[model samples]
Target: MMASIQKRPNGSWRARYRDDEGKEHARHFDRKIDGQRWLDGVTAGMVTGTYVSPAAGKVTLTAFYLIWAERQVWETGTRRAMDLSVRSCSFEGVELRALKRSHVESWIKAMSAAGLAPLTIHGRVRNVRSVLRAAVRDRALSVDPSEGVSLPRKRRADMAMDIPTPEDVRRLYDGAEDWFRPVVALAAFAGLRLGEVNGLQLADINFLPRTISVLRQVQRTPGMAIEIRSPKYGSERVIPVADSLLLILSAHVENVGVYGDDNWILPGRDGGPIWPRTIAYHWDRLTARLDLNGVRLHDLRHFYASGLIASGCDVVTVQRALGHRSASVTLNTYSHLWPNADDRTRSASQSLMDGALAIPADSLRTAGA
Candidate 1:
């Protein structure tokens, strides 16, 4: 072991040692003998193959986050969120080896105190934890410092049904230009997400069956090109179209300037897929022109589900139409929109109570006879 001891002007001794990789590490001691003893332990640890490289954990948090982000394969939007989390983090020069549960808790508390939305804080904290996890996987630490640390719970996004009423939908559709009318129609009537509506190809539509084959969707992930991936929750399902929607879609396919069967039904100027963003911008302007506020592109989907539930569609039917992962997911989102639950409960109770009170018709007749 090539280790050295130096005496400081303040009468403290310092021991320096190099690991197998020639990285130098040092410890301070009150006496020369203590410094020598510390070096001995390091040398012994190296010989026993129990050596932990301090270099891994000594990396700055910002540096490690950059390294970790490069290897991540999250979609563009999610990747951007992760990148923002790291960029906006306060632990600029914090050392990974010195990270502790207290540090994580302090960060969580600080974020909570800053009045950030619970979901945003949760995502940022999760991104930080995942970076530390990568360090652990790299053997920088024996235990995850983030393990068992309390993080803010993620509150679900507001999926409330602030839908455009039927009249509003008509006004918006009527205002849309020729190229965008079908897009509006699909969003308002078919409840297709922005990506799904943009990703539709002519072959995916079946006029005879009056259904849309939702095989893929356009997503803008971190890379240069927009990705075509399965729908949210990785669900691939067919959604039946209402007659009015089917007719509009049929007319669009026949008359509107759509890309060919193999291409995006709604193609951009360059003859490829139209960006969901561009479509959203159009919708934004249209909604503003029509004086519709607090309406999101996703609200169109909620409108479809709410309408269905009000019209007595069951949870499974809604789940399939929305392409959610499960019926529970559908119910959790729109259960409040279900109509007449109190009335249904009253009717059921009334029937049961009436049955309990009634005497058999034949029993009174037999007694009289």
Candidate 2:
């Protein structure tokens, strides 16, 4: 039923309505017109399915988050990140209905002032925005306060991808522990992400065809056991293994027999897939020992991509080889590494001119006089 307006004994008007849950909400207004207007708005909101019970708005952001988070279908790592992001801010105690754009903007300003990286601030802002959006969907909020909030921009230096040289990769390969060498080889030779490397299994490697099939990846969230999941969306692919990389894998297999049920190339303690943290432990030791500061294991993937670009591979080829979702992603990251259009055009013209001139042409000398 629609809201009812009544003339009160004190000459004011009372507007009252029963919510979907049969809870009554009432407001006293100075005039009958005001009460009717309020009732109309309440009716409209309810008709449009946008009505929020007066008490629902009283729930704090923290309380709402606790309720909303449990219903989300997120990966464990994603949930952990979201939890950390929520805890990083002070606005959790704010009531959902009381949250204002200024409050969100102020939170962003505080994070920026604290010298957080633009990416980190952006991530937290995104997480908070998601929660606020959910509140709107659940009718706890009329609007998302975090909408249209500007964030700090990433500097050029922060955006630059640091690709290690082949010599640096060779040094890293030589310095790594014998068991960890295959990790480096897979990353440097085949552009596999760390999780993919850790998820590698002997069955995924086809010795006859010399191809590495990236099918799955190992994921870990704090306080949870490592779990195996499919590769990052659209990143499942098969990379043709180079003979050298194949030799490294062969040697590793010979050194450590692959006899497990899962046939994990780099098995964890229980002879299942190795955890990413274990790989990180070995990687930290190797990098620290070699004094290769700031050179992460992911840099090897960049090194692999750069090598493919240097070898004249096209954007699409590199995209597929690197298991990127699309060529645009490949170009955006490695466009600078590709040869310039002007240089390629000039080289092609010069080669064509040389070939044409190579055909000796006898000069016409007045009928061979």
My TM-score estimates for the predictions, one after another, are 0.68, 0.83
**Predicted candidate 2 versus true structure: per-residue lDDT over 1-369, tens digit per residue:** 557989989999999989887888999999999988988888888888777777889999889999999998876677888988888877889888788999889989999999998989989999988998898899998888888989999755325778888888999999987888889999999999999998888888888998999999998866678888878754889888798898899999999766468888886867677888899988988989989978999999999998988888888889988988788878777787878889899878767876987533333344466
In candidate 1, which residue ranges exceed 4 Å CA deviation?
1-53, 66-73, 101-116, 137-167, 220-233, 260-263, 308-320, 325-332, 335-344, 350-369
Worst 10 residues of 1 by lDDT: 152-161
What C-alpha lDDT does candidate 1 achieve relative to the native structure? 0.77
Q: In candidate 1, residue 108 scores what lDDT?
A: 74
lDDT of 1 by residue, 85-127 (tens): 7776777478877777777778778888999977778778888
Q: Rate the local accuracy (lDDT) of all candidates.
A: 0.77, 0.86
CA RMSD per model (angstroms): 7.6, 6.1
- What candidate 2 gets wrong by more than 4 Å, as runs, is 18-24, 43-51, 157-159, 233-235, 259-261, 309-369
